[model samples]
Target chain A: MYVRAHTWWTILRIALEERLVYRGDFALGTLMRFLPIITQIFLWWAIFESIGSGSVETAEIANFTFPDMVAYYLLTMVGRAFSSMPGLASGVARQIRDGEIKKFLIQPVDMVGFLMLNRIAHKLAYYSVAILPFALVFYLCRGYFTAGWPDPLTLAAFVSSLILGFLLGFFLETSIGLIGFWFLEVSSLLFVYMLFSFFLSGHMFPLDLLPEPWNLLVDLLPLKYMAYFPAAVFLGKVSQDELMLQLGIQVAWIVFFIFLSRYLWKRGVSRYSGFGG
Target chain B: MSEQQPVLVRVFLTFARNSLVREMTFRTNFFIQCVSAISWTLMNLGFYLIIFHHLNRKPLADGSGWQQNEFFVFLATTWIVFSIVQAFFMPNVQEFSELIRTGNLDFVFLKPIDTQFLISFAKVDWSALANFVMGILLLTVGVWRLTTQSNNPLSLNLANVLLYWFYVACGVTILYSLMISLAATSIWLGRNQSLYDFWFYITNFSRYPMEIYARSWGWSLWGLFTFVIPILIVINVPARILARPLRPEGPWLGLPLSGFAILATLVCLVISRRVFSLALQSYRSASS
Candidate 1:
């Protein structure tokens, strides 16, 4: 068991090294991804200036002050950085379609385990390189963080939510990829999934700002855990009791997704046909 | 040039036919792709509906902000322009690097045709037309609501409507220039897979009202995007022509900006053409 654990450790180490090979490009990409925040900031400023009576204190749209709105946007970016899986689903689907996945079946490796470790390595590398950009951007927007840092307990909850968000994102994407067992082409499905996630995950705007029926319905979905909940926790928008309850719900969703993915993989493997073999 | 125009038309028609045939080979895939595009359009519409609902009571300080119907018109214009780019140019530009990688571009060069024209119109993404249709539908609804519901109904003259479409054409041209130039960089960079990511970043600027970027600090951004990239005028000018033909902010601003947008389109096309030529000169065939 110790030896097996060590083998996985080596795999993770190698994957981390591989990611570092493209560190420069990755870092630049991360910074470039934040460019949209320029427009967001401008748009919000305009909105508040128009709606509110000159000062931010007067502009309370859906209980979000201008500073709170700005803070929420920045925090959501952090949450998204943790949870957004860029190419995992399409990469897995391509591997499955091309029959490269058969190598995992024959080798002494589980595909999902291997992928998960690689993804963990990727995150480790990403966060290490991405921290500088996040720092710089946040520093530029420090004035917006009027409420300052959360307390230790809330901070801890925020961190936990981010980590869980990552796991949930991974499993969700993996399950989508596993659908490649039945369908050779999953790109369209993946595109549709991405669209839903972009809107539903609160990446566009705060979920609370959305009107009724939508606000209530989107809350039930797991996507809010990826972006909205973590930021909400950080801003003290969610109370301790609600945070705990939401965290519990998040864990439930993650566990449910994991089991569903495992079941799909098992069923898929039985039907999976290696093209040449 | 006039005689060759019909030949160009024939070539484009043939290309469109071949593309359609290729797409039709997998009918289920084509249907799925269409559904996927439509779903994204619906989600975006829904999202904007929520936002506009929140801002229902609050107009801009100078009445420059797009209200529910006006903003929907802007959104529809965005979709139309984006759809045209995706359908006519994006798929081709995306494949340019692959063509270089696989050495298929050598054959493209050998053909008796304008390589840029051929490369730009090679593949037609028919599924993207789903969003184009959706955009028109939304535009009609938005315009109807704008005329009927708003206290101050905007005038929509035939000349302005014609100019709106002309500006939309200009927008498409500018996007094509930008994309082709970006794709040409693949010759030097060798497999630049982040083209789409970079494209999204730049185009996201055009998604909202140009007036938002006219604030104090936004002046520099306005200059950069207007003169440097010219993406600011792409969707905004056309949308404004339809939704509010008479600019409440400044009357003279729209005419001069529209003229500049047309000039900018021409300048972008020439610059992109030059860039593509230079990049092609630097290209080493894959076999070599």
Candidate 2:
């Protein structure tokens, strides 16, 4: 067990090193990503201005004042940063299609465990470089956090939700990629997944803003845990009573996806033929 | 050189035909792409629908003169412009760095035809035209709604329609100019992976009505995009002509908004052409 843990640690260190080598461009790219927030500020400001008759401070649209809306968007960006697995699904699909899965099958290395560690390393490296830009943007928009920082207990809930969101995103995407075992190409499927994820995960807008039946339907899904839920928690939108309930639901979804991915991997490997090599 | 114009047209036609053939070879992929594009449009439409629903079907929150139907027309115009860029120029510009890195650009220079023209029209993703069709449908619906509404001042005459299309062309030209100029930087940067991200960010400002940016704190962004980048006019001028024609009294410096759009398009084109040539001169080929 000790040797195995040491091996995984070595894998993580190498992955982290590989990511840090590209840290220069990573910082610039991450800063560039924040440019859209300027547009968002202008847009929401206009919306609130019209609604409040030039008094944007008091305007509330869908329970969000102007500052709350801005803060929500900023917090959602943080949540998305945790959950976005840019090319993980497609990359895994490619490996399966190219028969690279044989490497894991032949070796004693567990594919899911190995990939999860690599992803953790990737997150560590990404956040290390990205933290500066995040801090800068957050500082510039600090006025929007009108309620200021959450209480310590709420902060703990927010932090835990983000970590669970990360795991849920990873497992959910891996399960989709595991479909490559049956279907040689999953690009089209991945495209569909991306489209749904972008909308359903509340990256585009808060799910609470969704109307009637749609909001209710979206509430039943686990996608909110990835983005909307954490942002809502930070903004004190979620009630104290519901916070524990929501976090519990997130854990349940993560467990469900973890099992689903492991099941697919086992089934896929059992039927797998080591062709060409 | 005067006769070369006809040959260039022929070459463009050939490139378009070859691209269609290539697209047809992947029938399922093309179908899926069309579905994906349509799905995205629907989702965006749904988002706006919810927003309008919240406002009780009022004009955009800032009173930007964008009622639901009028905004739909603007949205349609955006989709039309975007589809043209996506179908014709986006794929080519995205692959510009790849061509540079792989040394294929050297062969592009060896050709007798205009290098910029050749590179820009090399491939057409026909599936992206699905958005074009969707845009036309939405445009028809929006126009129909506008004409039928009582007390609406919308004028759906032939002159307005013609002017709308002409400005739509100008909008497409401005966007194409911006894209090509950004792609040209790959010659210096070696690999401009952020080209798409930057393009997405810049063009995002053009997606909404220009009035949104005219307010406090937004004035600087409004100035930057309108005068310096000129992207703000791309969709705004065209959509305004069709959706809500600006009153003649509001002309900027004796020129109508559409007139300014035409001038901006010309300036953008000239600037991008100069930048492309300048970048090409600095290109160190793969062998070097």
Candidate 3:
């Protein structure tokens, strides 16, 4: 317990220091995240107008009305905030292959902790640069504030769901980065992850937008929980019952990926004959 | 000059062959990238389906001629065109900027023939090519859907289609020029990938259904991209050519638009040449 506590703080410290130095490309990445949101917002706006001035009852088709839809997208700006992308994962995996892990293995700091923290640093840098302007534009363009429940319990739900969303993403990305141990190539793995995340997380559209059976299937998938769940929290769209259920799902996924990542790392180390071996 | 031409051709052949062999060695990667590209394209198309499906029961721009199917066709075609530009020129522009950042131009400068051509064409990753092929396939699917709804099938009018193909080629050229200019900024900044990404980010504009984002400020923003950047024109103009004809507003001011696109290409080529020379001036040995 003591060593684990030490490891967590040590990771946070390193992450904080790294976050202080901003890379120009980090700014690029932040701005890049906005492009899809821009397109999505416009796409939705056009559809809403064509829907002939709120003809459909908001409560009937799905949980979201026009204003609710806007908020859902805005919340999605940071929905998977704690997740690491395959780009960074591939870089770490390369280090593992080049046997750079040997130097780190000798260090007292936790290995996976270092990788996750580094990503958190970059994610912080990315969001700080990109999210605010986007949020302002989204709200102003939609001509409304997003609906929210002001209850303390709702806040707690949002906080836990958001943090869990990040953890789930981090563990999944790290576990996949673990593939570098077994395979010479990690790029393919990363590419596959992007595709899965896009479809499963409901990034392209709301989870309910997908037709019925697929919609139910996606909800069962962990991707929907990471991005769609938190966005639903912001919009006050999910039922309290659904919220508890999805949060449970998110926790399960994080546990699954954590174990998967640990197994892969142990197997990888057996091959890591150390630097200059 | 005659003696040097063969050497240039030989170098090009050798570079192309080796890169192909290197890429072929990773067949699994090629499949993954192909699937990934197709999935992202489909995901966006799926979003389009949702919007139009909802709108199908609704009204139009002025609440007239607002068929959901026609708009999807427009989106699919432009996306295919955009994917093509993305696959080909995006790589060249990305590589050029990186070359400046690492001061890696010394090797290219030491080589024979035009350094610009050499630097630009040396690398071709299929991530871009795969996106183009998949995007075109998706666009073709859109066309098939549109055919079921239209009077004149595109298959019957092959000639005009071929003429429009020339403009598509020109559109590709315009895209390449605009990127080369943005990439030229790297010579001064050491790493101007942010600038290239900023331009690529602007491509998000092209994904919207037409006349939807044409609100005054937004439309003109699109117009500025048409002139200064030219990426928007690559998608929108070529798409406009294929889908429709010269408007009574006289090609919707596209004649001057084409002229401006050509002039921008000239300016881009000159600026990149001047910057490339300056970057070479800063080049130092790796030991330093």
Candidate 4:
């Protein structure tokens, strides 16, 4: 068991080193990603300006004041930084299709475990480089967080939700990737997944702005746990009791995806054939 | 020069035909792409619908003259212009960095055709045009509603229609110019993986009405995007011409925006051509 743990540590350390080599690209890319927030600021300001009849300071839409909305968007950016698994799904599918999974079949390394460790390393590397840009952006937009920092308990809840959100994002995407065993081409499926994920995850707009039936439907889905829930927690939008319940639900979803991905992997490996020598 | 024009047209047609054949080879994938594209359009429309509902179906409070139907027209224009760019130029520009890194660009230089023309028209992504069809449907509905429901119904005339299309072409040209210019940077940067992200960020500004960026704090951004980068006018000018044609607003910033749009297109094309040429001149083939 100690030897197995060391091997995993080595895997993570190597992955982190590899990611650090592209630190420059990650830094610039993170900074570029924030450019759209400028547009959002102007857009929401205009919307609230119209709604408030020139008194933009106190106008509320869908229970979000202008500052609150901006703050919500900013916090969602943080949540997304933790949760987004870009290229992971497609990369997995590619490996499975290209017969690269053979290494894992013959080797002692478990593919899902290895991938999870690699992703954790990637997040660590990404955040190390991205923290500066994120801090600069948050500091610049500090005024928007009108309620200021949350209490310690709420802050702890926010942190826990973000970590759980990361796990849920990973397992859910890994399960989608594992579908490669059944379908040779999963790019189109991934495209469909991305389309729904972007909207339902509240990346485009707050799910609260969604009307009845739609909002209720989205609330039931696990997608919100990836983006909207953590941001909501940080903003203190959830009551104390609700936060606990929501956190529990998030854990359940993560567990569900963990099982689903492992099941897919086991079945897929049994059917896997190393066609080309 | 005139003889070369016909040859270039033939080459472009061949490229499009080849792309269609390639797409047909994966009919299921093509169909799924179309479905996904249309789904995205519907979701985007739904987002705006919710916003309009929240606003009580009124014009933007910023005095942008963009009511629900008019904003729909703007959104449709964005889709149309973006679809054309995505279908034709986006794939080619994205591959440009790979060509540079792998030194396959040397073969491109060896071709008898204009290097710029060859590089720009080598591939077409037919799946992206799915948004074009969706855009036209939305545009027709938006126009029909505008004509029927408005206190002053739109006067759709031949001249206005022609002008709208002309400006749409200009919008496509401007975007293509920006894309090719950015792609040219791959020659210097070796592998500009961030090209798409940068392009998306820059164009995100053009997706909304120009009036949204008219606040005191927004003036600098407004000026930069309007005059410096010129992305703001790409969708706004065409959408405004079609959606609010009868309005007597002379021009924005006291300049004739429509005329300026044509001028900007010419400027952009010339500048992109220059940039592409300079990058090619500086390019050291992979062998070197």
Local error of candidate 1 at residue A263 (angstroms): 3.7
Docking class of 1: medium
Please report how far candidate 4 places residue B35 from its true position, in Å: 2.1
| DockQ values, each candidate | 0.57, 0.69, 0.42, 0.71
Ranking by lDDT: 4, 2, 1, 3
What DockQ results for candidate 4? 0.71
- Give the alpha carbon lDDT tens digit for every residue of A111-211 in model 4: 99999999999999999999999999999999999999999999999999999989999999999999998896688889888888899998888888998
**What's the true lDDT of residue A70 in model 4?**
92
Q: Which portions of model 2 miss their true places by more than 4 Å?
A: B245-254
Q: Residues B110-203, candidate 3, lDDT per residue (tens digit)?
A: 8756877787667566565676666566556655665564554334267546645665676666556556656666766667746755775766
Q: Could you tell me the lDDT of residue A214 within candidate 3?
A: 81
| Rank order (by DockQ, best first) | 4, 2, 1, 3
lDDT of 1 by residue, B50-159 (tens): 65666665643325747777888888999999999999888899889899888889999999999988899989999898899999999999888877764777767789
Error of 2 at A150 (Å): 0.9
Lowest-sum lDDT 10-residue window in model 2 chain A: A46-55
**Runs of candidate 3 exceeding 4 Å displacement:** A1-11, A23-32, A53-63, A84-92, A103-110, A113-142, A146-150, A262-276, B1-22, B25-32, B57-76, B110-112, B123-127, B144-159, B245-288
Candidate 3 lDDT, A121-222, residue by residue in tens: 667665675565555566465654434354677778888887888788888878777788878578776876777777678665678777667877886678
Model 4 per-residue lDDT at B116: 89
Cand. 2 Cα-lDDT: 0.88
* Top-scoring candidate (DockQ): 4
Clashes per model (N, Cα, C within 3 A): 0, 0, 0, 0
RMSD of each: 2.5, 1.7, 4.6, 1.9
Distance (Å) between predicted and true CA of A223, model 2? 0.6
Summarize candidate 2's per-residue lDDT along A1-277 as a digit string, tens digits.
9999899999999999999998889999999888888878877777778777667878788899889888988898999989889888888888898889899998999999989999999999999999999999999999999999999999999999999999999999999999888997888888877887788888888888887788888878888888899999999999999999889889999999999999999998888777896
- Candidates 1 and 3 compared: the better one by DockQ is 1
